[model samples]
Target: MSTAVATATPTARPTSRRRRRIGSTEIVYLALVGILVVAGVLVAMGGGNLFSTANTAYMLTQTSLLGFVAIGQTFVILCRSLDLSVGYVVALCSIVGATTMAGDPSRVWLGVVAALAAAAGIGLVNGLVVTKLRVNAFIATLGVGLIVKGYLDTQFKGPAGDVPSSFQMFGYTRVGPVPISTIVMLVVAAVGIVLLTRTRQGYHMFAVGGNVDVARLSGIRADRTVIIAHVLCSTCAGIAGLLIAARFGTGNALVYSYGLDLDSIAAVVLGGTLLLGGRGSVAGTVGGVLILAVLDTVFNVLDVDPFFKDVLRGVVIIAAVALYARRQIDPASSRARFRSNRRRDPVRSGARPDPTTTDGGASA
Candidate 1:
């Protein structure tokens, strides 16, 4: 009889993993900080202060309205759908909310409920058109917007209805430089962050956005997710409508002319959410909103021409999208990350090598 033993070569552990480069979100904030610094210097050069009380207030006030809509835009974009009707939704809801309130404090709640209900209903229609009717999201939303606009154009000649002083507090009240509207917008953003990270619907949004076919294969109801996303998006637009009513004391039929539909989409894209969908964060969107706010402030302070403001904004948006396109997550990095995780979670992966295991046998 002879004994035979085999010694397996020990699997060497990776000594180090490549550090993750800064993510698109982190880079966005860094760019924002850079812009603030540069803008501050420019303003100071002109014998003006960028952080003046009035300037801060104005920047934040603008940010609040855009933030609300952008956050909602984030939801639908994450589900791979776009809502071109948000500007119109804001217009409609402002009219609905303000008209229902009719300058009566007691009717504020009723107005809010009515406005939100209307926005949600429109969202349902938009979703149905896309899902049930098999229409493209862009065309479906645009068509819905046109329908809403036609009604607005025919029925109202100018601003109508008014918000009472009590409701106006939502737009005017502030904690120091921060308006209550901005604070509420931040709260909404917090809620959005939680939804994306800790809820089933949030996960479904990602799954559906990643690939509708794959999502269905995995038992996710993609259409339902999109509808929910649009509803949430429209509800956010409704909240924005309330802000408009609060600030202006009435519903302005021309509010959509501010070009918010494109602005909100730009902010979403600026936040690093893929235009095609499936990847982004509310925090990032907030940062993007702030960036735009800063630019608006800077332009006002520098006395840049209104036409030039649009051009500059266009440049920034294009540059940002192009810059971040190179930084998207790649398969090589993903595999490396998996290996790194497996190494740290030895028991879970069971792939970690153990040098101590050996084989010994005796054969006759």
Candidate 2:
């Protein structure tokens, strides 16, 4: 028994270390921390004052806007769906909300309702098309986005209608140097974290994304999960549109400069959310959003060309996806690889393999 215990102790340490090393969330956390450090260094070298109160405020505000959209996208993607229509929904909602306000502070709530309703409606349509009609998500949302874009073009050629002062205040008001929008964003994210980490519905979403057949067999309503995710996604977009309109004090169908649709997806993906779904965290998504905002600010300060910024963004997205994919190793394959490597080690060459290693490694 003493010898058996001694043997087991050596095995446990390597197994624990191996598990820690391969853990997807752990890897993502480390990567995020490293990226933030690098970003800080770059910002400092670029002559950007990231630590200044004003710059910190600006960063949080910008991050807040993008963060909402990305938060929405995170849910949708976690359910193994995409929402290409979010950008157009943002544009359309901005127009509807702004136009409804028509400079009346009292009627701002009316615009808010209309905007959110429209966004939710769009989400429902996308969900129906994908789940009921058996349409591909990418195609369904893209078609919806195109329809929204066409409607936007016909409705207005440029910025139209005024945003109410009350709405503007909601967007711009600060609490001891922190923008109200940023505060709202933090609240939204906190709610999201709770929803995903602590709720039954959130678990079902992950189950559905992990495997639709398995989810159904387990009595989960896969389609309903998808629909709910899309609704939340579009609703978030609506909220973001409202904030954007308030920030600009006007409505423009072409308001988002970096293409909120793709940017949000990029942020979600960069934050360690699997594009294939079933994995991610709100905190990771927030980290990803901040990284992007930091890079955008630094590039602007360095006078980088707009075209180069686009290229760099594309490269970053691709790299992030690739790195994420690398960490998604199959347990069976990992165990097999470990055994094969063990066989090649000189000290372990003639040793009888521990039968428990495969199961333990795979579980890890």
lDDT of each: 0.91, 0.84
Model 2: per-residue Cα lDDT over 1-364, one tens digit each: 2222222334332433334455545555677567667766877887776557776677788898899899999998999999998888888888888899999989988999999999999999999999999999999999988988888888789998789898899788998768999888889999999999899999998888889899999999999999999999999999998988898788878864448998999999888898888888888898888778767766765678999998998887788788777767667768878886875673676776665543333322
Clashing pairs in 1: none
Candidate 1 lDDT, tens digit per residue, 64-124? 9999999999998998899999999999999999999999999999999999999999999
Off by over 4 Å in 2: 1-19, 22-33, 46-48, 330-364
The regions of model 1 sitting more than 4 angstroms off are 1-14, 329-364
Clashes of each: 0, 0
Poorest 10 consecutive residues by lDDT, candidate 1: 355-364
Residue 59 in candidate 1, Cα distance off native in Å: 0.9
- 10 residues in a row with least lDDT, candidate 2: 1-10
lDDT of 1: 0.91
